[model samples]
Target: MASDAGVPDPETQSLDADELAFSDEGIEATLSPADPESDIAAIFDALFLISRLAQHNFPARIDIHTFAYLACLMSIYSGQPANEWGYSFSAVPPTLPYSPTLDGAIDRLVETDYLKTSKSTDVTNLAEFELTPEGERELGFFSTLSLLSRRLQFLDASTSAAVFTSSAAVVNSLANEPQLAAATHLNSSRQLLTESSTARLYDEFEALSQAIGKTDVNLILPASMYVSYLQSVMRATAEEATGEAVENA
Candidate 1:
């Protein structure tokens, strides 16, 4: 007795299943639309911090890389967790991890004339940048945004002399971050820096903040502690590395 006409043979059934699995329509149907909200937030965060830093360092242009480094510090000081923050960086030695998100943010700002390029160079990161008058206006507008009020307050706190004497010191501290050091060590093997790598640092910062108690003036205290912790960790890591090298030698 022959099978029903509508029934597919085993070979035909396999071919049909393969086609459904590999077809462009099938693949596209399984994928979700990209949500750009996170990326947009990241751009806004970068813009706010970069503009504030630029204003802080007015009349003195900084390289793109420095802007990114300082922005990272500002974000941490603003109480953002490492994973929840808007930017990601790769471990780069002698400096803070290089952030492609920040690099793109700078590019967008320059293109929009919110930031001015003082010295154009083949390497965009090496070129000097400062906030434009329009950028200042933009920052003013940002201050009015309800979403940014807390961040603006954090920035204000961080810039006050009570927190740190200079943004330059904050920039320099990036070089000594133990997490960055670990990432740099792994970078040679092409490993990406994971957010978990900085979890301990963030946890410590939170613990310190809780211990300090919350108050208007205390907004900046945690940031100071975070920097101090980074310095201590950096020294310990360097000493350990050096001792190992000596023993091996």
Candidate 2:
């Protein structure tokens, strides 16, 4: 059930508290907020804006899990030093990391009518949500802010607008992220993707940026290439696995 304006439903309120505790403990452990001008501070602000942007631009109704996962991906692609973003995710088997901060943001948005719950047909029975008309209006207001406008414009210029708007492409890219493969290899149920874990990804983007040269390059250009690389990797992996299965059969 959806909540009234300014009041979240009971389930949402409970989720909000739990998510807040998890985010505060997990993120604060990795990112110190003592320095206002630090990269960590910038990453946090970008994370906030990116999550809202993901919500606003998603082409269809999204479940909390999917929304959170996509927001994480968008944060990485937003050109911030990924290592400075202190988002920690616990590996949920057969899915991407469960991000407490992003999840909580969804609840908060629901409370403010920026998002609303929808019926779920999937077996997981998780409540799905869609951005409210008010949410679009709110994003319009945010677009007036220079920081967000720059980020949005960077994305628009760098990547095909269709990519970010497509749910399948977003999920496929995340599933194929090299970091996810590393986490799977660790064989841990509670694998935490820490800041250090993102160092390689950050480095990869940095390298791509340098190769492209700074004068006319947008951060999203490197980001789009990174995502495409991962997608191709997934396709190749799937083919390899299928062939091996055929041989065994």
Candidate 3:
């Protein structure tokens, strides 16, 4: 069920802590604190989260691209705060990537039976899409993957919490050993760069991993290599047939 806020009602929401049981331990500390700087990020997170849930749950079909586009347009029309759309929308016309532009991707999705288009309720508007049975099966797989990802995130948060616990323990231990207090820099110089470097590296690694995963390796992998692999299998089959013919003779 949807709320007046235009997002799903939390009570009716399917993907919740009770339904999925993603690890909750030590994640409380890692939860992001809301502030003005994070407004745009929060908007996107909300938009995508609701979009995925809507696609998976709602009877009426909506693709992510269409939903995002319309939502942005409507938000502007309804006088949503400037900060919500500012940083990303400054450009007059944004560049969409090659091969699978929004239109192209939607077309391909429909062609592959992942989605099906139907006439809109209002004739003035364009058609909307709904998931096919195949699409729902794919969505089930996606949900499974999302559950695993949440578990991993929770595990990571728990490890970070453990580190904080260990650090506190060390600080307490140092308090007992007054001699070591002078040796430690905990109260004095802060090495911000060293502390933040690991986090930056992790962010880079995650970004690279995501980029690599999204890449169409079929476009990059040599066609000749695939041909050679198939040819070797065919050659082995031909040799086996020859041996069988000779035995029969």
Largest TM-score belongs to which candidate?
A: 1
Worst 10 residues of 1 by lDDT: 22-31
RMSD of each candidate?
Answer: 15.9, 11.6, 25.4
- Candidate 1: stretches off by over 4 Å: 1-36, 55-84, 92-95, 154-165, 188-198, 210-217, 235-249
Give one digit per residue, the lDDT tens place, for model 2 in 1-249.
111222111222221111211111223344333332232223323333434444445322222344344344444444333333444556554565555554555556768787665554553235555556876676667556543343453334323422554545655566665566666666555634454455555555445445555513443555566666677878898899999999999
Candidate 1 has a TM-score of 0.61
lDDT of each: 0.49, 0.46, 0.30
Per-residue lDDT of model 3, residues 1-249, tens digit only = 111232212223232112322121111222122333223222332223233433333312222322332232222222222223211211111111011123434455567877665554563114555666776665555444332222222122222221322322221322211112222324432211122222432243233334444322221111122223334545666699899999999
lDDT, residue 66, model 1: 42
Error of 2 at 112 (Å): 2.9
Quantify how close model 1 is to the true structure by its C-alpha RMSD in Å: 15.9
CA lDDT, candidate 1, residue 57? 62
lDDT at 180 for candidate 1?
60
TM-score of each: 0.61, 0.59, 0.24
Candidate 3 local Cα displacement, residue 218, angstroms: 38
lDDT of 1 by residue, 1-249 (tens): 212332212222121211222111111121111224334444555566556555556312233344344344444534333333334555565444565555666678889998886665786456656777887787677566554444454454444422364666655555565566565656542212244354555455445545555422444565566566666766787799899999999
Models sorted by TM-score, best on top:
1, 2, 3
Off by over 4 Å in 3: 1-63, 66-102, 120-125, 146-249
Give me the overall lDDT of model 3. 0.30
